[model samples]
Target chain A: MTPQTGRSAGPGVPRGDLPHRAGATGWFDTRHRHLGDWAFVVNRLSGLGLVAYLYLHLVILSQLARGPEAWGGFLAIATSPPVLLFDVLLLAGLLAHAFNGIRVTLLGLGLVASRQKALWVALMGMAVLIALAGASRILGVTS
Target chain B: MATLLQTPRPGADADPAAPARTLRVRRHRRGDSAEGWDRYTAPVGPRTTVLDALTWVRAHLDASLNLRHSCLHASCGTCGMRVNGRDVLACVTRLEDLPPGEVSVEPLRNQPLVSDLVVDIESLYESLDGVRLPLVRTSEGAPGSTPAEGVGHLTRFEDCVECGLCVSACPIVASDPEYAGPAVLGAAWRLVAEPRDRDPEPAYALVDGEQGAWRCHLAFECNEVCPTDALPAEEIARLRGILLRHRVVRWLQRHARPEEVQP
Candidate 1:
């Protein structure tokens, strides 16, 4: 066992069981508190998801330009079992993306303070709503 | 000739009052190939400002002077120019407030100079559009009922005015073109931080990718130069923290429910 230090193993600590500390630095200076790192990642992922959805939706809608026969054919294929599974995955990603945005908004605006539970509930609620709407669309329920 | 002395008349030019100091301003005349400073002398009063002195110059000395000033107050934000190499609003900056005879004025930096003082600000508008700075409103207001209620944190993050000062002041944009400047980030933050903006996770992910929020070195210069006091660096930091938390949550959820974890 390597000597136990006051810092947590930061994804690369080998053969050492160190007490977890929030931040650590070399002997000379302390590490800077960079809380914004996660927001940056989430923004990128969600943005990509949104962009992909926009493009995919546009491509799927192109059937209209090809006439009603093309549209009906495309719809038939989209409702297949494999496609429905893919749609569920897409819906999950979409809901996650949207909820993450809500979390950022909450903290950024100084509202809801630091209550993680409340934020989670709000995010989960949005996901449920989206999932419900997606299910209705998938099941061919009339408006 | 017998000695005869006439009493000097002290009525016209002499007075007991203290002499007023003359403010000499450096002017860059238009149509002059070499834009150099020309001294414009003005009598200073107790409430005189740099704008007042420049107004005097334009009125008395140079009729063809070129400059822009609207609502000689801080509201318009149009009077932001370089004074002694620092950005400040000319209307509010008093001449007496600064060191005497040590004043210089120049147009805003890092923008296309249109003639003398005005710059082409249309590029800023275009850049804003590039970032898609729009309120992600829900499908049209349903009759009198409000659009689908946004999450709890949406309203406060929507207060950005797109002043361009933050962008102009950002060192990142100056050095890296791919680094979407502070103005863009601020808008992104507003969306990510808004409860009404639907899914902020995607926005967060967007900023985390290459040449995005990670590119920002936490210089705090953008926050310093922001006239609106929007603490953009802090906002960026918060956004990053939220993203990390999201990852942790995902990891925990996946680990706890292996069956729920999708392939």
Candidate 2:
């Protein structure tokens, strides 16, 4: 949380979290938000989830330190139906975040600002199709 | 301001022939610790605006109910508020065009509340001043129209209207109070795009930083809620490109030999 530059509202006058202003925690408050709002919230959430998964993955890979028996036991748990279901969801999150990230970067660099909504829909559509294919491959083999 | 303390309009709650709707308005006082809503049932015809409904409430139901409006048109931008969770000018938002049901009218978000349905707009104006863009411009594409006797072009005052609707609709502004929001950036872009008689490089320099234009996440909610179509999101991106190209040129200049100075 780096410090922001000084604001014009000055410093001391408290800016109250007025209702319907969608405070810091209200990014996901989807009453009448636009598609870009939803895309932004989804991107942030998926990024956070991915970061947490990275740490868990390192710990899971540490099973090798306990010898071959421990590693095999972990692999058995990993291949179960519930674990495979989690994998499918994880793939969806990754694809959604990655594709939207590309769109955000392109727009931020002033590439295509006019058709941003259309660009978002196109990128997310591709993400959905890829996620569906990956989910079928993962779940179908398990079942 | 709505005329208050007069005899209550007869059709507010008693008439059986006129159409009516319930308005769920957010209420807050200066010293109140929390906020809540007060529902007022007002007699509304098809063309009755949200401002008209609110004024009706002030006249017939609750005299203490507070709001602000000047020109009973969208040009003033003083009647901005959220109707059905979207920012709009209350003077133009007719009841018939809104989502059918009890309409929820809340004050603009992310700013301090002065009273019911009116936020303290001092900060919004202060932010505009910080950018230093004169809020006036010539109307575009008004060709073949008459100009003043000595003037070359017919000029219009402004289009942005200083409504703060873009600021309210922006999520970045909601999260980071210091972020130079859509309206400011939009003005900055205009300054840079057409400097007129003045240099715009300083205006570009003002917004080259993180809290300036780079902080935007391209939500484009500002563009959506902007009543004037100023397209702040697009302008912010343009500002970023200018800053990026300037930096690249400076870098090249630094690394170039003394021959680069001969030109």
Candidate 3:
């Protein structure tokens, strides 16, 4: 009996010509979502967000070198409620990124790498706890 | 043979009169053909696995349906395919785990397609050949003659079954064909980590390239899809750590002993 070959191209046709489909995205494929994958996605997004915020913060701080008037004008906008809320978001992103970074480092060190799911849960739990505490302090919601 | 193929689901209520389930297999006539998929409805029950359905279809409905499976159990690792868009072992995946609609079966990814539901896994094995995997014991001691105190508990490192499923699930291998995949790298780590292996330098050289451990994005899909719990992603991470440590040591040595460092 003739075997049913999966590929239909002739010998002369290059393999590259065939349709080659990778994951749903280059790295983030929602179709193959797992717990570890979700963690990776969150870590990547948070890291990028933190890097962008770093550059933005530096740009804003550079205005201080211009003059007191310029600095005071920028500070006024920075201290606004919307800016404060954005700071809170940045704080949450920073905490998540930092904690997840620690988790990845620990995994690299082979510390509790076998129980990665548990480690992720524990790190995420810590991130949430720290973010909540920081948010409470930022909003003056103590008590 | 059909009776032997029946694998009852765990804690599943036995139903003798269950209705038949459909196994829709995606077919490609050649590497560039446009033939999409072929559907086959078989008399499936709770005990039927994806492999059993394929076998039934081949034996009864379409004799031309090509698939490969050796050990009906998960040991042989020959029946790896995509079921419902996820890489899985056909011999072990049960019908109950699939959704309510028709079960879809496709060939494994990151490899050349041989036929319907059959891929060229020899490419994976060929990649392993470049790593030079062999126990390199330099000491002229007999087997089991060396001290087994700390080395006895290293069974976790030797869990690679070389199924190629990890290669299929690995995104790096899909994106970059030159990248030595998780399975081969995991095997390299296993060989290198063995205390009895006196010469691990070759394995180190193999993994110290651009397509080595650094290429992995730590997606952890290989660990998730492995049926034997090999944890290849963990092994790759350990390999990266080892490589990083070696690089650091070499850098320090070069800086400290400038006379000994060769240009």
Candidate 2: misplaced stretches above 4 Å? A1-21, A141-143, B1-8, B11-16, B134-142, B145-158
C-alpha lDDT values of all predictions: 0.55, 0.78, 0.74
- What is the interface RMSD, in angstroms, for predicted model 1? 28.2
DockQ of each: 0.01, 0.26, 0.27
- The DockQ for candidate 1, computed on C-alphas, is 0.01
- Which portions of model 3 miss their true places by more than 4 Å? A1-26, A30-32, B1-18, B33-35, B135-159, B195-198, B244-263
**Candidate 1's residue-wise lDDT over B132-171, tens digit each?**
5446444434457565454323433344445455554454
Report model 2's chain A TM-score.
Answer: 0.81
Interface RMSD for candidates 1 onward, in order: 28.2, 12.3, 7.2
Could you give the candidate ranking by lDDT, starting with the highest? 2, 3, 1
TM-score for each prediction? 0.47, 0.86, 0.79
Number of the top lDDT candidate: 2
Standalone chain B TM-score for every prediction: 0.65, 0.85, 0.81
The model with the greatest TM-score is 2
Candidate 1, residue A3: how far the Cα is off, in Å: 77
Indicate the TM-score of model 2: 0.86
lDDT string, candidate 3, A114-136, tens digits: 67788888889999999999988
